[model samples]
Structure formats: C-alpha cells, structure tokens
Target: MPNYWGPFAQLKEQTNAILEVANYNGLMAELNDALFIDRSDIAYYVDLAKEAGGPILELGCGSGRVTLPLLSGGYHVTGVDNSQDMLDILSKRMQHRSREEQSRLTMCREDARNFQLGNAFSLVIFPYCSLLLFTDPADRKSILKSVRRHLTSSGLFAFDAPVQESLNQERIFELDLPIESGKTVVTLGIKTYHEQKVMLENSLFQVAKSTNKRYTILEYKKLALFAEGELEQELQEAGFYVYKRIPTLSDNGKTLRYLYVCGKSDTDTYPLWHPYMPHNQLPNHVLTLVSGQGCRVTDQHGKTYIDASGGLWSVQCGLGNTYIIDAITKQLSTLSYGTLFAGRGNEPALALARKLVELAPYPLEWVYLTGSGSESVELSIKLARQFWHFAGLANKNRIVYLDQSYHGTFFGSMGVSGLYPAKETVGPGLPGLDCINAPNPDNCPPNQDYETYALTCAEQLETVARLKSDQIAAFIIEPVLGSAGVVIPPQAYFDRIAEICQRHNILLIVDEIATGFGRTGAWFCSTHFGIKPDIMLLSKGITSGYLPLGATLFSAEIGNRLLAHGAGIMHGSSHNGNPACCVAALATIDVLTNQQLIKRAREAGHYVRELLEQMKNEQPNVSGIRSLGLMAGVALCQNDHKPATKEQVAVIYELLKRKGVLAYPAVSSVVFFPALTITDDELQTVVQKLGEVLSSVQLVNNGTRMR
Candidate 1:
C-alpha cells in the first residue's frame, strides 16, 4: 500500500515557490475578501500595534498582508522573508507608495528561523499561517528564541498557527473550490505526514481557465498543525512569555488557527494570579457546616476544623450563620434569579450594590456582579478597556498582572495569570495581558533588602508602561499574594504599586477575591496596606460560603466616566447578581460587621501564627510558618537540606488527614487555612495535630528511612 503520509511529505519539499508574486496590496485584498477581514479585526490589530508601540518586524511577511497596512497606517515596519522575490515585490510596492509611506517600509531577505535585525522591535508579527512553514520542533523553538532576542524589553510578538484538531483528519481532494467571479478547479494531494511534529505536506494544483485555455499551477505547502500544549512549550523554551492565544477569526474547524501574543520577561510588577484548574479534578469538598451565634462550622463527618482559610478565603462571618442563611432562604422564596442587562433591575441587587458602595474603600461606587472570581477578573478587564475607549485612549488596551498571583480561572483571566502549569493544558486564551515578578518576602533574593525588593518589583509596572506606553489600560493585582504559597509582601509594596499606577494613569485593579471582606482582619486587604485601588475584586468571603458571588467594585471616577458616556459595560455571566446570592452576601456582611468577625479573625490569626511558630520550632520536619490574618502556609523541611519530594509531601498530607485535620498541600508546603472564626482551643488542636504529624513523619532519603 502506498503511504499517504509519504505523498504529502514529498509535496511540501517540491513546493518552494517564492511568495514574490503576492504583493502587500494583493495580500490585503485576499485577506479582506478571502479571510473575511473586517473593521473590528483591523481596529484590534491597530490597537495592538499602538500598545506594542513597535519599530515592528514581520517574520515571514510573504506579500505583506499585515506589514503593508501597518506601514500605510504610519507604523515603522520591517518585512523579513527568506525569498528575495518576496522582498522585491515588497520593495516595488513601497516604491509605488508616496515618499512618506515608503519611509515606514523596510525589507530584509533572510530565513526567519535564524534571522536577526541587530535590534528588537516593539511588535513582531507572523501573520496568515506563516508559522506553519517551520515543521521541525527545533526550528520552531529556534525561531521563537531568535524572535524573543529581537523584541524590545516590553515589546510583544504576535503570530497565528493552525490548531491541531482542525487538521487531524486525513486530507481530502476537492475538485473545485469556489472563488469570487469564477470557480477555481483545485486538486489537493497529501504527500507526507510527520506525526511527531504534527506537520503534513500537501500538493495543490490550481487549474484556472482564461480565454478558454487551461492554465495549471502546482504548489507544495507544509501544513503544520500545533497541538494545545506544543506552541506554548516552544514559546517558553524560546524565552517569550506566552500571554494569549485567541481563536482564529475564521471559524472553519478544518483550518483551526490561534493568535499567540507574547512579550519578553520584565521585572515583577503586578500580583501573580493562579490559572483555573479544570472542574474535572477532585470535587471541591463543600462542607455544609451547621453553626449559629458567632462564626463556626461543623462538617457532616462530625469533624470541625476552625475556618482558617475562611471558606475559599471569603466567608467573613465564618459558615452556617443564621442571618445569611435566612436572607438566602427568604430571597430564594421571593426572587431567585434576574438579569442585569439592558437596564433591567432587581431590588436585592440594587440594595447590595448600594451597600457595597457604602462600605467600599475610596469611593468605589460602581458595582458589577459576577458569578465567581474568574468572571470578576474578566469583567474588570472589559471595564478597563471600555474605560479607555470612553476616555479616547482606545489604543490603551494591554493589561499587566503579577506573577504567581491567583485570580479566578477563566479564559481571559487565565491569560493574565502567572501560574503557567495550570494554564498549560488549556488551549489558547485572550491576548495583550502582561505579567511581572511579585514581591515574595519569604523567598526574597539573597542579599536584597525587603524595601529594595518591593520597590524594584513595584517599579516593573512603570517600566512595562514606559516600554509599552499609551497601550496599557490597567494593572491588576491581589493585595496579598494568594495561591502561589501566600507570599506576603512588605507593607510598602502595594502603596508603591498604587503610586506607580497613578503616575502612569493606568487603572489599578486590586483582586481582593481571596483577601477581601475581612480576610486580612480588615474590610479589604488594601486597608491593611493603606492603599485604595481604582477597582476592587470581591468574592469568596462576601457571602461567607453560603452562595457563589463575586463583585467588581469600581471607583466613582470610573463609574462617572462610564455613566457620563452612556456606556453600558456589556459583560456579565448568566448567574450574575442572583437574588439569593446577593441576600446571602448582604446578610453575611451584616454578620461580619455586627458580630465583629474581622477583629476576631485578626486576633485568632495572631494566636494561630504563634502556635504554628512554636510547633515549627519543636518539629524537625517543620521548617517555616508564615501567616496573614487567617491565611497561613507551613513549609515542610527536608532532613538533609534537600527539597521535599511530592511523594514525601503526600505522605505528610495523608498523615495529617488520618489525624482528622484537613489541610491542603501546595507544591512542597502544607497550607493551613482554617476558618477565621476558629476558637482558640480549636486553633491549638490544629497546631497540635500538625505538630504530631510532623514529629511522626519518617524522613526517607535515598531509599533509606530516617527518624
């Protein structure tokens, strides 16, 4: 039997036509007609270039579809192609243009895989399936590495490649492919399939009839189909930060393509956010704790662990509070659901909004409700972009986030999150989001002072803005670093970060999802840092674990801007502002304020930390203990100064669970997040259980067990 993969492989080798016949103008025309390029796509690319602020370079510019338009729009563009014929065509096109337009166009003939321009560009584009040419993984990695070296410190690199599923099936030959004016008789023959690289080679025969004469042309094309995790790994290996992967404008499943936008790593700035773990993982243990009076929870298993982590770091009044339960029950009986679109209003939502505005820091008057933290983050991005449009800075749409920060996991939010591992499996996400290093007091670089580290980390925001000035719409962060091991920053960190955002006119979005509603013993974590952000992301604690809800609290300035412009922010989830959820939040807030759980959380956190510290001192396996309010991380030490293995950590975790103390193991450390309303006795018991587990833990090194 003839090998089908062999034919495609041979076809790609034979089709080496110089793309010179396709000029920039011709390419644009093809894109406009063939690819369905519209005003929105143009606007998005233009804004991307503006934010990217590049002396731009287009790798594999083949006929200049994107480069020419950008040049015509007054952007400095350098078009690179290995084929001299293509560059000749570009040169001719540039010469035909006016002198001013010609000045912005530069052409270079070089292999994209190894090309270097001796300098970096603010933006580098590999448009129109150009990335498909590199069938070798090493070549792709090499091209990305070279591209990374050619990018300005804060510049962006954008490209599009075919999706794996789109080309996974066997290629079929079509007799005639419809085209404008006439039908082009076309024949496609797959010659080879390189399964390792997911690349296929195919021969295309175009037979066009003109003046009743048949003209035939045979072209060999290499179609490289990128799997979900492949491109990201290559980009990472090449030193480019993979920021976004947007779906292709063309919805044809057969030609699935994604737009990848990346940039160079700069200094750490925004809070590192966590990517969303898929729902398929272990079901979130929802312990319906029955409680009353103050904040307390007893699980159905008849085991009660003081709420330390504060139900998902929210649940300010702890769990099973009567007021919140009653409020939710009452609201459910009346109006359970309502939409918040097109001027639609619900009484409970309005009341909750009003109450949030009253209690929010720094005149946060505009309230946007979401179903979860991820949704809230997405809304915040939309609001920032919309605000920029409203303020006539439509070009500023890039957002910056911190490294290792844990934001809600959604496609848009995941693009901004720094936890690469969680997002690695998921396919391409949104574009134009940037990340910087975050201040980690626990893991500060040796010899660097905390103040210096904080300033240096915070200043990365300004650096990113200056590098990509006029393009940044907002800087989002969490007041206290959560998820990437709860690494708290110095007191001056957030204050300086706020100042940097102020200096750059960038909207500062504080993700208080895990730190708000008295999680840090203050109404919001920002209060602990003595700073107020332009927007506050509140969730988890708002309803004290009774309902699912999140809020994007906006400042009066932004609210007035939106209202004055009559701009209705068209972003919300279906379950947004659920009446029952809102009522739960309202009642939870009442309980938190009336019963003073925030104060208690503060006092309890102090006591818990002291106990954890004493336990650490007595236990050999316990290395470090850090706490902020009710949130805490216990770092397990190794016997011989080696890092604790996952299996070792798992063993410790199993031991703790067996002792009836439930805790989460994060990477190499065990997280101790009990409820805020945990009694002093319960706190001691947790400390004792943790200590017992550590003391009994058998240290195994090199297959030998040690006491």
Candidate 2:
C-alpha cells in the first residue's frame, strides 16, 4: 500500500476540465474530454447486438463506445447522435480501418427523435440509458414513431434506463480503475434527488506517473428515472411489444439499472434450426424455447405464442400436464426403457394394449407399437403386403391412397402419399402405389354441389380398384386429410371408400396421425362416419407430444390370420412398446377420458364455426372457410372460387404469424387446428386477428377479386 500511494509523488502541472455526458440536453452539449468519458458495460451492448442480428441503428453512439465492437462483430451499424464533436472523434478513430471495415460503420449527426434513413433496420438500440435523455413524452413518442417506420417486418428496438431504486436513500461511491501504464482515474460520486430525478455529481482525478501529469475534473449528470413496468406500458401504446425486461446489477451489487428489449407489433419469424429445410432459408439463430404451459410456448427472449396446431395436431391433452409429467418421471426413474424383442415384455406395454382394446370403437383388436407415426405407417404398408402374401395372393401387393393425401415420409409411406411436392424430391418410391381422388367440396367442379363432388372423387377409388382390383392390398386414407392442409371430406366419401375396399377384398387402412386421439370431435373420425377400417394407423396425440409412440391396430380376423401364418408377424422394433413412452400414452389416454376433452372439442367446434362464419362475411379474401371440431381451414381464392396460388397462401401465413397467430400453411390454404382444450375466448381472439389480417390484404388478380 505504501509503494502504491507513493509511486506518483513527483510534482506536475495541474489541469482542470469538464467532461459532459453523452446526451446532456436535446443534442445541445459537446463532449470536449473524450478520453475521460465513461466506458463501462460496452461489452454488454455488443453481446446484445449479436443476439439481434443486424443491420443495427445505434442511438447516441458517443466515443464509439458500443459501435466499434458491433462493427467488429460483422454487423452493419449506423451510429446517430446530435453531437458533432462526438461524431468527429469517432470518425477520426475509424480512419485507420480498411475500406470493408470502414463501410460497416456509418456516422451521422441526427437526432434520435426524428431521422429518416429511408431503409429498414433489423435492430435499433439505444444503449447506456440514453433513452432517459428524452424527458418529454412527446419527444419519446416521436422517437418511437420514427423507429417503427425504420424497423423491418420482424425487427426489434431496445433501450436501457436507470431504475434509481435508492433515490431517496443517501448513496456514496468511490471507484478507481486503472486505464493504462501508471495512470488511474478516481471518481467520488454523491447522488442527490431533484425534481424526483437522480442527479449525480462527481469529482474525477486523473494522474499519470510516467509523464508526471495530473488532472482534476468536475462532472454532473441528471436523468429522468422511470418506475418498473412504466416503460413497458408506454412502449405498448407506442406500437411496440415489450419482449423482455432485464435488470442489470450495479457495482455495489444493487440492481439499479434495467434493459428493455422491445419489438414492433408486426414482428414475425426468428432463427430456427429446422430439419429437412434449406439452410439459406432459415434464420441466423434458432429460437431458444424456455417453457411451455398449456398451449402457449415461451421463447428465451420472453416471447410467448400459442401452439394452435396442437404441436403438429397431436397434443390432445394440451401441454404441461402435471399428471402426465409425473407418470413419465416415475416410469423413467423406475424402468426407463424396455422393448418387445427376443420375447421380452413390460407391464406398461401390455396394460396400454389392453386399454386400447377396451377404448376402441370397433371389434376386438390386436395392437402393434412403434416409435413414431412414420414408423407406424411404414409398418402398416409392410403388414398389408404381408397379409396378402400369406393369404396366397402374392400379386395383390400394390398400395393405394387418395390424391393430395399425405401419410408419412418413409419410403413405403411416401410412395402411398399423393402430395406431389414431397414426393418429387425423393421420387421413384416403392413402385406399385396407385392414387385415387380425395374429395374437396370447396373446390367442386363448376355446377356441381358438394354431394356430387364427393361422389365424383370417391368413384376414382373404385376406378383404380377395378383396374388393379386384385393387385391392390389396401386403401389408406385419412378420415380428414391433415398434411395436405386440413381437407375434410363428407362422411359419404370415407363410407364409399370403405365399401369399395371391402368389395375388392382389399384391407381398408385409416391413417389417423393428425386426426386421431379426439382431435376431430370423436375418439376416431372414422367413427363419426359410422364406418370402421380393417386396419388403423395411429400416432401423434397418442402420447400428447410427451413421448413418441405409434400403433397399428388390426381387426380380430386379420390378426388371427396374420398370426396363424407360420412365424407370427415377423416384425420387431428396437423400441417397440418402450415402457416410458407406453406410460406416457396411458397417462394421455387417462387425461383424455377423465377431462372429457373430446366433448369440449365438439362444443368448441360449434363456437369456432360461428366465428368462422363471421370471418367469411367480413374478410373478402376468405373464400372457403371450413371448421369442424376446432379444426379449420380458410382457403384463399379468386372471386370465381379458383384456388389461390401457393405464393399468396404463404403471404397470408406470414401475415398471421406477424400478428402472433401461428397457423399451418398448406398448399393454398391456412390450416387452423387449435388444441381441443382451447377456450372460447382464445378462439375468438384467433378469429379476430386472422380476420383482421385477411381483410387487410384485399388483392386482385386474374380479373377477379380475392373474394
């Protein structure tokens, strides 16, 4: 201590100077002492900028405090300030950089309240409590208005301000930070309250031993302190959504500062590392989901959105159910895994299979389990072929599916799907798969009512079956088409297809990946039409998204025949009937039965249909609005009732997402399959937002209006 204090004892010339704060007053003051300006927490700004994914607009970019770091991090930054001297100093610092690095930083002496760059920016940041400089409410509104215009479609605007939690309490702080060799800055600050704002007055002493130089300066600053939750409300009224509010700790370990991250109300889309997607089309950083409760999921940045599609139309019991979680936890802790291989078995698998037989709406059955819907569908294809081959009809092995229908993406399942786009990429799938027309009442041929259209499409199945009558092993169809964009045909359509399969001696397979588990107002939508398929493919809401489980259910007769043939169903999965997953399915089924969610789905369906009627009346772009049991689709079209182009449907999807109502985008329609447990009020809100957005995009094309 003695050596440290006495090292700079040599006499030197004394100097006095005043170092003003960044925004002293309304872009009026000049910072003459740039070297002594506060430079704390500059790294925090840089990290936040990286999260935002710029081009960035930095307000009050004094002394290149946060700008240089942002530029170095590969972000294009435009620094705006009202101080010419500050801009000049920052400009001088940039002189040594190469052309490319220099191009990343833009300097301008413009007021934050009003400036027009004539372009959009992804992130607009006001660092270092600069937002507090705008004391006037009008000034704040004007600044936000400008920011809103300059923001991109999904852009964010962030700023920080002092919380001043200890305003009335007396506070004293002394800080000595070493800058360079033999030089130190010592600040003694006294905080006082004036006009309900914190005023900081400090005496700074700078001394250097190598040059024997000494300097003393007086600094004074005042800020309009805001209360917690006060800024969030103001931001909302200014057309910005409060994304996150973070409290930053002070040097004394007290949280006296806060950072408010905000986004425009029209913001949409974030970085997501998606599978089976082109990398160039994805965002820079995927959304970090933190917690999910009910149908809503909260991301890491504190943004919450409803999973209306029931997490791929399978979250039958909603999410975050304590009973389901407890069941999985208990099973995992006791017996995490067990499989149906080498004659091995577990209690959960047998218990669930027994439960399925009891709950089934058809004749007594046998159940085969797998890990996912694709696996189940793939197994169904194999089982159908196996059943025929064992029955002495080896040539009857072709699979048939309704046109525009989607089963799964595995080779056999994909071969049976009629979705051309998905099949185009992985073409030449399993060979003998035939197609039949799926009923689409909305797009009925001219002068044909829905019944006529239904019959016309259903007859295609008979046509294909007659041509390849003995060659077709089974006819697979979704009671209500799911991945082809929520297409729901009339009951007669499925009934006719079932009748055809029965007559042709081909097994009828129901693919219920999206429509099973009480999603369509019934335990199984095939029951809604009063018909039973010879075989059924089930997954998705089976585990309510808690775990993966797929099952293929066969009638007693087919099960007996398949088992009687020599080697008793020569198929086994590594994870067939996984105990933990089976337990999850059991819990999910218990929840479905105990909560009476299926009945509520029907009730909510009526509520949703009424709302859709209103939407059809108000939104000119809404041509065909279909709603059944909380599952709906609003197909866009020309006034002539022609299907809208795929591009237009994508645009509608973007608009809905920007408004925070996420819907599945289909070929030419937006799929609306909210959870069966969704409240009436939530349904109403979704309809209102979707209707409002649809009404806004009144486009005209091909000599026809959107309606």
Candidate 3:
C-alpha cells in the first residue's frame, strides 16, 4: 500500500488475471521445464572472463541467465541472487545436467547489495538491469560498496541500468494491459510523475479489439528514474570509479540503456562530446532533389545548394544522376529484391561481389553484403571471430578500435566504436571491446607535423598489441576519422597501422563507410592513405545514398579459409544484398569512373582547403581548419582558448541555416561535407554565405573579425 514493492506489485496484480484464467502457476512450471534455459548470457560472460583471465562472480544471476552457461563453458562460476524462486529454478536446471557441469557452478542466496563471500572476484557482474531495482539511495550505495569489496585489486565491475531519459519517456511503461479473451481488449499506461522518492503515477487508457472501447485512467505509483549524473555520483561515492558508460544501441543517436564498467582505482574521464551524445539540437532538414542533369540537383524548394554533405556524405556522382536512376529503375523492373540465403544468389549480388573484389586494393576476393553501415560492421566482427575459431585461435577474440571513430549502430559496432556521446542514451552494448586514443594531427603537441603525429598514433597500435598480445583478433579503424570532427590522419598513419597488425598477426579492418566512392578524393580512403587492410567495410557512398547497401571485403587468404571450411558466412539479414541496392551501387561506381568524379573530388578538396585556410586567417574566431576532399572541420575557438561555447556554435549554425546553407556542429567545430561534384561557382556561394554568417555573429574574441 505504501508503494514499497514498486512496480513489481503492480506487475503481479496485472498478471493475476492471466494467471487465474490460464492456470498461471502450472504454466510457469511448464515454461520453466521447456524454456531450455538460454545460456547465451552466461556463455558471453564466461568468454569475457576467459579472455580477461579472471575468477569471476556474477551478481543478480536471475534464473541463471549467466551462471549455467558459464558452467557449461567450463569456467568456475559463483552466482549470487536474492530471489529464491529464481535460484530454485537454476538449481533444478543444474540438477538435470551432468555431474561435470554441476561441479563448476556454485550458488549463493543473498541480496547483491550487501552480500560477501570472503573471496575477491576478478570480474563482477550485475546483469539485466538488476542494479536499477534499488530505488533507495542508501541501498544503491550499499550495493556499490559491496561490489567494491568483492572485487579484487585490479578487478572490473560491469553492470547495466536503464538510462534515466529512457525511464522518463512514456513509451517504456506504456504497455497494453490484457483483457478477457472474448474481445482481447487492452489498456496502455504511461508514467507521468514521481513523488515521495518512490511514488510514481501514470496515465492509462484502454482499447478493445474489433470494438471501440477506448478510455483513459490516471494510474498512480510505478518506478523511479535516476538521472545520468546521479548514477555516476553514487558509484563514485561508493568507492567505485566508472571508466566507460557504453550504450546498448546507437542508430539515430539515442541510447535507452547503458553498460557501465567501474573499478576501485580506474578513475579516467574523457572529453564529454563523443559520438553517442543524445543532444539532437542540430537543425537537420532533408532536401528532396527532384530533378538533375550531370552533377547538379534541383531541390523541390527550387533552391539548389550544390548537394553538399552529399546526402550524409555518400553521393559521389551527385544527386538525381541519370545513370544511377536508370540502373535502379531497370533493376526494380527485373528483380526488385531477393534472398541470398541457402546457396541461392541473384545476378546483381554476384556481379556486385565481383566488382568489389576487382576494385579492392589488395587481393580481397570475397564479399559479404548487408543493408547498412552498422550491419557491415557487425558482419565484419562476426567474420573475424569465426575466422579465429576456424583457425583454432579460440583465445583470439577481442576487437580493438580507436577513440572518436564512428563504426556503426548495431550492438557489436557500438561496443567497438569510440563515440561515447552517440551511445550515451543507448544502454549496455556487446562486451569485449578495447578502444585506443585516436590521432589528432591538428591538435596534437605543438610544432609536431601531421606526419609525425600520424607515426606516433600508429605506434599506439603496437602498444595495444603488446599489452593484449594473443587475445586480440582484429583491429578496426576508419581510414580517416569521419564522425569525430572529420579528423584526418597523415598519409603514413594507416600504412604504419597496417604494418603493425601484420606483425602482431591481428587482422586489420578499415571502415570506409563515409570516405569510399570518392568522398575522400579516391575510390577509398584506404587507397589515399596507401594501406591495404585485410578487411574493408563500405557503405554510404557505395549507393550514392540512394539505397542502403554495405559490403565487407575480405582478403584472398581469409576468403579461401572460410570457403574451405563452409559454403557461406553464417550471418545474414532479411534485406541482405537487395537487388535494387546492388544496382544502385554498381551504377554509382560506374558514374564515378566514367564521369571522373574521383578526380574532381581531389581538385575540389584542395580548393575547399585553400578557402577554409583563407577564412581561418581572416576570422579570428576560427581556431583550426582541416579538410580531406569534401569532408572538413572548421573549429571555432573561444576567447578563453577553450572549445567554442554551445551557444556561440548554435548561433553560427542557425545563421547558416537562415542563409540557405546547411551544416552541423561536431564536437567543438562545424562539419562541412559538400557533395563531391559542386561547381566552382557554387562552391564560392557556399563560402561566401559562410563568411557572411561569421561576420554577423558576435564573438567572444576581439580582433578576430570575419570579413
């Protein structure tokens, strides 16, 4: 009655009807019998522990989510859970298994918040949002203190909790409450307020199937939502220091859940504006290019702005090109879409694979196709792991990435990507990823040339390899840092990284999702950097952003190994290798080669760099400028020599929007990614408008006048 039980009491009552009508206890028992007890979570944690070489303890191991599989994997697992019902289920499951499995599992019935077993654990886990169950601040503090005590000196405590914003939103709790079977009427409820530290009230409504029975009710008292800062402060207060708060999903830049890694002494904080930040303040608009001729596009608004940013930095042949449109139209007429599974393949899929192989720098002979950049990155990691298993290097399963690099949005990609802001809203991602600091040639130690900075960054890769050694299976990086302020490394940076991977027997993967298809003045950024990675990931510009298409190109050696082991890769999607998307990519490549757009990109990039340099010199507020082809970053500095203030950057961005120019601020800078084929006159118009915006905006620094 006092709301002490939180949402669980409501959940029980709401489910009572289903239980009473359907023999709930019997159904639950049957479910327990036939459930097969999914051990994937356990297998995952076990694999992580094995890789980390740890004696691990899993807290809140409800229904043996991570305990049973760890036992099956032959890892010594000590599982702790507060619920006797869940532990009873796990005990029954273990009893049915062989003696060998039962030997590896140890169970303790105790509250995770204050339990201690008199032994230190190398890895401690609080899985499945179990930490969020502690609504009281004191209880949460006690849990963190207990975890710290249980962890060894160098142990890591990994846990997950629903993000505060995720809980504040109405959708998460707005589930449809079921009704009698006659009409299957249901009610959807949403939490609206919180009171008295534990009381949460919600608004509810009901709708009937086949009949109109809709109503709204003010439902009261549900759950507590903790802000991001509150969670961090609590952890810090309890003797635990958080290093990473990894997001669960990062598609359009919002994450609902977070996976936090904390340790006793691992107190490290990074610059807050990583890719996973959920601040959607940028004024983004889609310009519908209704018609075009050659490399020009006429938008529906009748105002053409040279298709800069290339429709998310992909359109290499410009927009509304006849060649690509015709190819796509033809493909839709012939075979719009088809499944590539079960040895069945389409002409477009095969032809596209061959084309990628032909164009790849090294002996990349095989291709795996997907629908987007995220899918491509996921497939690359899966393939790398599979290859390691096939080659009998079971211990080699870790992925290494660079900080501030944009990989993709899938769970695995989110784990490997270094953009924290983009993933902040999304909660806990796949585990077993290591991120190293990326090279910033423009902002590195003063007096060091870009080339020297590149070399130093490449050496960091060797440092990671030496530290992790045989545990690392692959190293993935973008040839030029794309999402993190469009930072570009020196020419020799990627080349040296490739050499280091070769020396360490770690597969090198290059993500060219944004920079491929002439976005970086070449067919691929890897080509411009003069490095041939063992695996090449491509999307975006592949289809000129007309359709979603991503491909993972593998070297001949890895391809042959996979082929010899099996007929095809194990993973796929419903829209994998869509014929229409394939045709779009093929047409896009054809346009780039036949129209010489890649060459245009190189020349245009040089021109844009010169213009930006002129602007930087003229505008004192301009801190630094870096450009590679159409991708550029114009960093604005504050009077205090710090990064530009959000308000200042926002003013400049809004001014550009009003002046018919479109660009977004990245970190402490504005990203300028115009289409590759803009004419000289059109390019001048963009710069002139930008100059006008800067001139009008008041700045913190005096004598830094915009002309």
Leading candidate by lDDT: 2
Per-model C-alpha RMSD:
24.7, 19.4, 25.5
- lDDT (Cα, tens digit) per residue for candidate 3, span 472-578: 88999887776667787876777688778889899988898888888878788777767778888999889988888999999888888887888467789888988
The better candidate by lDDT, 2 or 3, is 2
> Candidate 2 on 376-445: residue-level lDDT in tens?
8898888888888888999999888877888777887777778745566765679888887778765677
Q: Least accurate stretch of 10 residues (summed lDDT) in model 3?
A: 278-287
Q: List ranges where model 1 is wrong by over 4 Å.
A: 1-307, 420-422, 640-650, 698-706
Candidate 1, 426-508: lDDT as tens digits:
76677888889977654567699878888888888878989998999999888766666667777777778777788889998
Q: TM-score-based ranking, best first? A: 2, 3, 1
* 1 or 2, greater by lDDT: 2
TM-score, each model? 0.57, 0.64, 0.58
lDDT of 3: 0.70
1 or 3, which is superior by TM-score? Answer: 3
